[model samples]
Target: MGTTFFTPNFQTSPVLQGPKTAYTKPKTREGQAMGNFLIDLSIGSFIHHLYSASNFFKEMVVLKSNEKCIMELSRWLHDRTGAYDWKHASTVVAELEDKRDQHQNIEMRLKSSIRQVLKCNFEQENITSPVELPLADCVVSGLLLDNICKNEDEYMKNLEKIIQLLKPGGQLLLFSSIDKSYMIVSGERFHSFKYSENFVKNAFDKLGLIIDYCAVQRRRSMNECNDYKAIMFTAAHKGE
Candidate 1:
């Protein structure tokens, strides 16, 4: 729930990696070069990275705690639109769960923890490739695509693919950012994305996803360490 920021050093986060050989951009002109403006504009994606020094440690604690992991995965049921809750789930430890935790009664806890671990926001769809997924749900397995699809087209395609990632009744919790913001990482200056609420809403609509929570950035405080807070939530899934 802190300012989420990402960057080229993403791999060092112990969560989202910055680059991957398997992940590739669309081979077309516009798609390949989307970085001209849109990529630079899509700064919100990296905002999640800013979290490393703040709540990131708390997140790491949660990942190390079984109880916290359970509470985290329970949010997956909130994905009514078949989209995973990446922000809240970026730090879960479900892959290493023991066989004893897989029992039906304890399954919820295990799923919850694993679900949080799969909070790779970019990997909404199973397009990239089958990953050596930590034993969790089918939806979270599309991690490779989320990791590889850095470009906008690949991102949108991944979102589309996420529609199928969920089971018939699974939920999707999606959201996007608004307002322009800035952050500092590794002693370098960077900016958040300049996406409008409408832009994000329409973008998700392209894939038939819905919004369960809609909170925009408020001027929290100029004295705060971070600069921007244009946050929002999209928690729903393929409604059939």
Candidate 2:
């Protein structure tokens, strides 16, 4: 038998709970833990959707444009593992070794756009281009340094931009850190200004996105998020 976690409804349900599972424990090694975790967890979330085929009416697109995350994920799964199609993802994973690079990872925003276009067999996906999109069914971002939105307005504007991209009935899944900083394997600090729930609430409110759920989870083993007060996962539903 295979591991299954298909949700019947996408109504802001709690997909993951406490006792967060680390995707990988790099243990100071330049590891492939993230690549493996990405392919696996990424698929798990989708397979759950596939199983909920009866409820998944609209098509999906991700928005992760960060260079490090976008590029690395691209090279690993598509060129390297062929993430275009989910067949034998496990097999492809078995062949890779942990070799993540600071520059190798792409931005977190480009991911959804790429996949949206790829659905048509890597066809030209011209959805998220010049001028920005104001309505989408879903948006996903690992707001790693969430603490930096100190100015409040700047943060809300960015959040508003993202919310605008989502459709009224769409969902926005955000993964972020609760602290103001992070330390990558290189011991480099990814710092941002501190933030509050009020700030987050206001951002979503300005964009007319309603909060559906929030979860505090353990950092993926691949992540060295051990120093954070908590890892936040928020599922917001866009309002009309």
Candidate 3:
């Protein structure tokens, strides 16, 4: 939402701790490291500390649904001037890893790991149909599906599309805002889909995904948006 979700300027912002922590978890890292390629869907502010996977994957492809997001990521990856300030997020990541002084190195690793930035259309059955993105060893998508789809049916279809992008037994990292209908971005409200934990788990089960890890962090206090009650993180693997 206009970089609001990725900025860590505020001390209370969960963007730094929530996602980075989930991504760096020992088991998650092990699964991610099993492959050489990663495909990131809806690459928002998640651009920061991407180095978390630098050691795991030889190359990374970041796919976004909008032109603006793609442009923002490209600027940051190339170290352009107008890119969003990700130092705060990167600092937190360094501290979490007990390498606070090596923050710059971590940031650089993330930048180098990314090989391409591309656009995707989730509404279509094959998100990158004409372009034909390679099926990846891992796919990470955060807060994209619920915010983009209008209804649950569309959400399910798109979820399948994302899974189709992964190789068998490949890992999928997902982050979602639970029970949210709308969020404010740059002073304007954006629509979001609402769903419960059961609904999410049922959908994943129906898709034959093996859930390896799941966690939910409830909102501590209302900050920018009143749309979500909790943040949901899940890691699963595609069936063989």
Candidate 4:
């Protein structure tokens, strides 16, 4: 098993578009604006989703489970000379919004909003243990739980830990693959925990989170890279 990084196909997947919709489509309560602080704990270093979120959040923090991922993503965000080319992802975002020509501006905005990158271990004894970091108004995670957790029990447990990082009334944006057992990266197969949509909704309900929006995109085409039946995007909020 090798470490999985962002690939062009993964970046262009329909499921990957869920974050933008989660951020932009929902209607907030009257006079209520989006959050000031946002934290992203997605599995890989791919940041295409952040471009949409950068427009709303005042500060963005990226948490990675490993130091290597942290260092790589940090360099990509801060080092201009050796930064990975994110223009393609930006263009996809722009096209989604029908603003193809403004991709450059979008890219710049995402780069500016990122405040820090830190290390996190989701498998800790007390996953919800207090840390020096402040609670975020919103936490965004993509394909993280399924990748890290070994079973459904651990998945739900880790989900609770992630929610602990949010403030009361804060929201959670989650992206997951439905019935996905594995994904191939660079011709290497990596394990992905399989779960159903009902399981996820129930987990949120059990935790007392109110789900605001949900979307599912069934696999429209076949590819040898993965065996996911569908992708699910959910936006839920914790009670105050």
Per TM-score, the best of the predicted structures is 3
lDDT of 4 by residue, 1-240 (tens): 111111123233342343222222222232232468888999777787777677678598888887777877877887647766767678767766578899988887888999888778876754434456788888989889988988978988889989988899888889888999998887899998999999899999999889877777677777787788977878888989
lDDT winner among the candidates?
4
Query: Candidate 1's residue-wise lDDT over 1-240, tens digit each?
Result: 222221122122233233311111111111111000000111212222212222112211111112333344344434445434443222322221233333332333323332223223333244323332321111211112222333457656756655555444344434343353544545675544454567667766787755443444344335332344444544344544
lDDT by residue for model 2 over 143-240, one digit each (tens)?
A: 53263344566566556555555555666656655654544445666556565555566666677767766556443335464356555656667765
In model 3, the runs with Cα more than 4 Å from the true position are 1-33
Q: What residue runs in model 2 are displaced by over 4 Å at the alpha carbon? A: 1-60, 81-128, 131-134, 144-150, 217-226
Query: Least lDDT summed over 10 consecutive residues: which range in candidate 3?
Result: 1-10
Those runs of model 4 whose alpha carbons end farther than 4 Å from true positions after fitting are 1-33, 95-99, 125-131
Query: Whole-model lDDT for model 4 versus the true structure?
Result: 0.75
The weakest ten consecutive residues by lDDT in model 1 span 32-41
* Each prediction's TM-score versus the true structure: 0.39, 0.51, 0.85, 0.82
What is each predicted model's overall lDDT from 0 to 1?
Answer: 0.34, 0.40, 0.74, 0.75
Identify the superior model by lDDT, candidate 3 or candidate 4: 4
Residue 133, model 1: Cα distance from true site in angstroms: 6.1
Q: Select the stronger candidate by TM-score from 1 and 4.
A: 4
Question: What's model 1's TM-score?
Answer: 0.39
